[model samples]
Target: MTEKDFIPKRYSESMEHGSVSWEAPSNIALVKYWGKKEHQIPANPSVSFTLKNCRTITRLDFSKKENQSDFDFEIYFEGNKKEDFKPKIKTFFERIVQYVPFLKEYKFEIHSENTFPHSSGIASSASGMSALALCVMSLEKKLNPEMREGFFRKKASFLARLGSGSACRSIEGDLVVWGKHQETRGSSDLFGIKYPDEVHENFKNYQDTILLVDKGTKEVSSSVGHNLMHNHPFAEARFAQAHENLAKLKPVFAEGDLEKFIEIVENEALTLHSMMMSSRPYFILMKPNTLEIINKIWSFRKRTELPVCFTLDAGANVHVLYPEKDKVKVLEFIKNELVAYCENGHYICDSVGDGALKLK
Candidate 1:
């Protein structure tokens, strides 16, 4: 909980680099990632592709203090200094130090920022902590060469999971799964991939236009929802459903069978919402605009058999996945129908993006 809580250090060292940074992209589930068997860890080993257009860039630098005995953490939203979020953050820094040990004596200052909404969904935590994890790991590498990738990967997830559940998934891309702690220990079967995890192969022909319907953020955080799973009887059911769906949907996506993929994705989307509805404090993030888009999409499916489909992630935003070949029609559909039924007159279209990395 604090620097004093850490059980002393096994190794200690200090070094400096100009600074390290990473731009980690957010990912949406074409097949949906929902529920969890063990809190922040994945329920059924869900996979996702990194978005190309949006991401969060993070940096870290250290300075030796002549007076202070402990490390401190700081965060900035846009350009304003924000230290109120430090308690949980400092706790995480302690975890990082305790696990790595060699960094225990040194002081650290974390500089993190998100490009999009401060916390208004759209997978900000996904890219935000992914960037953070990599930056921290980079610092560790520069200071200690004995640590391996496997050591940092697990340690990074452990640190990021405390900050946000989705943050664990942000550590990897193309296709990433927050491996169950039990399975990750030499279990090669944590996840499956039917299609090659390539940017162009899975996404170039596809377009997922996000319809930003303001739901004013959820009353419950995923962390709170995750804690609820301890008592939520239906938690196991949600986990099972996500597993079945992911296994079946992977092949559908690989074949580039749009119709099959949409069906699977939409069903998985509904299942994710079902978990939220069934939670103890029971809340639904869907809006009237959400259902209207769903209806129109279904009707279009019936009339034209297009591959367009809808997916929601704990918020009112409707991410409509369609073919880039249908861009004009897609844009027209958003402008015209949304004016008639959506929650807002404004929206942004984002394509699938690259995974987390240092910028050029």
Candidate 2:
């Protein structure tokens, strides 16, 4: 759908004060989205598995405001006031205010927390921004009771994209696709959509065990990394490669070709780092332990002939992806061989999930 389709008409109803809460899951991109354009449009089409256990829950309480000249909101993370986080939220509000115009009319209290540790290489922005966007959409739904369920979700994802690019994928399903691609029907750069094509049963309940190689914050943020791609020598080739890999994945996902899936996924992960490392002012986010864990996973997969593979976000941590049927053997290998590389031996076991949930 076009951007104009998401703009809402004048509301039929209004509330003086109310509260809304939602829990949104984190996602691991199989075909990663590394760069973007203005309005948070992605540089390439990407697909991801929505994660079950790593998530964020946000509750928004709003009251009618007497002074409505500016956006009014206070944000708390894990029950503690986080003044530093306000600017990001304010920027998000400003970006989406045109779409959800009631922002200035209400003073908001946003309480948010994550299931995974903050700064643990998890995409807290994906889950956190998505949860907050869902909460805001809930308020809009209340304001316009005539809004349809489908429209609500689409608009929520659109708003979430403004907060964080990857967040749009956290709004829906076991599999989600963001950005426009000829091969992926219904995909849009404006928002993420539940992958509409047939997915083989072999992928059902796929597992993702995250190994925390480093819990500290990164030296460079994802925004900076994406910006570097603007002048990157390989930027054009990488973007084209992502589309090619996504095309290759369609039949693989349909046929349940584990080997091809592994090839595409692992390549995408490494290529993401390659782009970062090759940039003019290059930097590395992967720690030494990250390589150690990857080698171990490769050895284990070679020895066991299992479908286990690894993917990385823009940080030192590694996400070990494998089919659900191999969970027992994979977890055993992870605990015994890979966990040693994790900081404090910390890891989280999670599986594919069906998107965000609204809480009463």
Best by lDDT: 2
lDDT by residue (1-360, candidate 1, tens digit) is: 222322333334457435777777777765455555532445555555456666788776665445455765557656677787667567666656555554444455566776665644475877776677777777666666666766556556555665565666565555554443232233212222223332334445467677777736676776666666667778777667666665665566556667777777788778777777887888787788788888887886677666678877777788888877877877777787764554446565776554567754
C-alpha lDDT values of all predictions: 0.63, 0.93
TM-scores of all predicted structures: 0.82, 0.99
lDDT of 2 by residue, 1-360 (tens): 888887777999989999999999999999999888888999999999999999999999999989999999999999999999999999999999989999999999999999988867676999999999999999999999888999899999999999999999999999999999998989899999999888999899999999999998899999999899988899999999999998999999899999999999999999999999999899999999999988988998899899999999999999999998989999999988988898888999999999999997
Model 1, runs deviating above 4 Å: 1-14, 31-33, 37-39, 66-69, 102-104, 119-123, 145-158, 180-205, 339-344
Those runs of model 2 whose alpha carbons end farther than 4 Å from true positions after fitting are none
lDDT value, residue 13 of candidate 1 = 48
